[model samples]
Target: MSESGGTFDLVILGAGSGGYAAAIRASELGKSVALIEKDKLGGTCLHYGCIPTKALLHAGEVADNARESETFGVQASLQGIDMQGVHKYKDKVVGGLHRGLTGLLKSHGITIVEGEGRLTGTDEVTVNGAVYKGANILLATGSKSRTLPGLELDGEKIISSYEALRLDRVPESVIVLGGGVIGVEFASVWRSFGAEVTIVEALPHLVPVEEESSSKLLERAFRKRGIKYELGTPYESVKTTDSGVSLTLKGGKTVEAELLLVAVGRGPVSEGLGFEEAGIRMERGFVQVDENLHTGVGNIYAVGDLIPTLQLAHVGFAEGIFVAEHIAGLNPVNIDYDGVPRVTYSEPEVASVGITSKIAAERGIETTEFVYNLGGNGKSQILQTQGAVKVIAAKDGPVLGVHMVGSRVGELITESQLIYNWEALPSEVAQLIHPHPTQSEALGEAHMALAGKPLHVHD
Candidate 1:
């Protein structure tokens, strides 16, 4: 192979959400950028993670709607799931987004390099014997599915979310290991798709990182939906059975299923990538960076799942933009991770932003919280969904957090993010009228109750 050399203002490794976002922002700021990826662009999110999973979730939602159409007074009959057709629909969405991203990158004049890249120096990366030099190098290698030491994924009966996504047929029964976002999401989808689903989590509650109240609510919803869970139990071992697989929990409880999905979590893809060789500090495979995302070695920086932060795609996007603007000498403000909105797209979606009550207490801040049942919301009643909006605010101070569980509550999180980031007071949010007969009204009503004016709610 002929060797080539090119220099750019920024050379980004791993053209996922973070790398691409940085490239676009840097290019927009009049800087040359080279985005390198070994696999397809848009990375895991578009290929196997967020995009495709959400498509499956949406399809599952449709199946659920059809099954429960009698409640809505609609004459739709419940039908079997078509896994082939679901894959086609999921692929179509991913394909369209990938095309748009490629076009956007090209329009910005960003160079797209297709190869596995390694940092040879602080300012240099070598890919396919071609050396690309940059004034700044960003590591955005993203993450991969993580599994336990003894539990090996054979990609068949024992599998991860990646393999689970590509399954041609829904299993008769599935045991999901890990009740965090990924695990719960897959459980929801499989349950809606007519599978007997069970979730195993070592934590005391599902979505353990979320507020305890939110976790309890989600657990209740899951229980009501016939989803089984073994909470606060650790995994011991697994063995492939004649039918599928059998999982042994901490207490010697055995659970059998046609498939055992190890949705444990994702680990950073930083090994054997020359990150440490270039003097970047790493702990447990995650690159350590300062608040500004600088690697403290040279002009090198790291973002996304490579860094020890919230491993969300949107977080990666924001971090990428921040790094680009920082490199451009714009002095961008540091990201307040707590203000970031988080959504779990399950049957009854969970969305939140800012600090929970537990977080406030940990920080020694006194707080008061209010919960507005969606049962009182007209739109929620119309949609036949049951959940609530929870608002947490400082004692006589600003709104500190907002959490919700209901259908399509993810759509309302942007406003909650603004409330949390701007530190809006309960009264301030109460004064602003949310549209009548909408799910958003739940938030407004919660704030109103907290602000000492209960509307359509018993004080």
Candidate 2:
């Protein structure tokens, strides 16, 4: 391999959210950086994962609103979904964001290397027969869609999220193979687009990682929307049929659909990139990092989905900033994983922050919990949405967790994130006023009830 003959202060592999964030922050802190990416600069979140999927979800929302316009006395009707037009709209949104991100990176003056990079030494990454050395190397390679042991993605009858986003037409029927965020979001989108959708989850509840109450609420909403789901049943096998595909569950129950989407989870892209050979510890393909995200090998570090963290894009962004500051000797604080907000942007959204009641019980912490129904909130009434906000707190301590299920509750999660991260007491939050006729008041009322005061709630 030929030598590039120059060493940067920081070299980041994978120009996804984490890698680009580190590059920008390190450049701002007056450090020379090299960002190597084999794919688009904005990475999965930009091109295929977060941005495109959310765009499709928004289109689905528009379609739903049009179909139900008479409920608001608007007297409107939704025409059939045009797949080509929907894809065009989604592509436009992605294109604009991609251009903006590219310009931003250029303005930061960080070197962008276009190739697949491999860790060759403690401080060297080889790409295209040229070795680029760095004072510190960061492994920011992100993640990809995961499949079950016997299942394989063919980009046709059986597919992953990547192919789902690029489909030219909506299937007549679909069987989504998981019930996590990705599964539910796609299920919601397809049902809204007028398709027969069935979700088969081995877990007991949809979005099992969320609070049980939130999961039950979402399940209720999905039932009302006519989204079919088979819970607690593991699929034993799948076979492609002439019309589409057939899936068989453990108990011999069979499900047939025009397509099957595998949305179980995402696994880190850490294989054959020379991470293990460089002496970096790994667990199940995920890089093992210390509390500070250090690999304990030279000045090497790993961030984003590459490490076994939250895997959310925002988490990746935060970790990237923290690592850049740490490398700059700014001594940044480590992130509290619980404080990161999680949102599932389905028709009736689900959002939460901080520890769940189950997690609290697992940690042997005593807690007090309260649930405030949206039925009591004027804004929810105005929107004609049914849901509730639940808050969990220490018996005499601060707010431990906040969970909500309703339309657009994801927009309210930032406040809950702040409250959780600040460890604010229920009384403290209750003392503050939320605007009248707003869903945010649901959270406020929940806090008030938890603080021994109830206004519109009957005891």
Global lDDT scores for all candidate models? 0.93, 0.94
lDDT by residue for model 2 (1-459), tens? 123535899999999999999999999999999999999988999998999999999999999999999999998888799999999999999999999988998899888888899999999998988788999999999999999998989899999999999999989999999999999999999999989999999999999999999999999999999999999999899999999999999999999999999999999999999999999999999999998999999999999999999989999999999999999999999999999999999989999999999999999999999999999999999998899999999999999999999999999999999899999999999999999988999999999999999888976
- Model 1 error, position 403 (Å): 0.8
User: What is the alpha-carbon lDDT of model 1 when measured against the actual structure?
Assistant: 0.93
- Candidate 1, 236-287: lDDT as tens digits: 9999989999999988999999999999999999999999898889999999
Give the Cα-based TM-score of candidate 2 against the true structure: 0.98
What lDDT is reached at residue 189 by model 1? 98
Q: Which residue pairs show backbone clashes in model 2?
A: none
- Estimate candidate 2's alpha-carbon lDDT, on a 0 to 1 scale: 0.94
Runs with alpha carbons beyond 4 Å of true place in candidate 1:
1-3
TM-scores for candidates 1 onward, in order: 0.99, 0.98
Superposing every Cα of model 1 onto the true structure, what RMSD results?
1.2
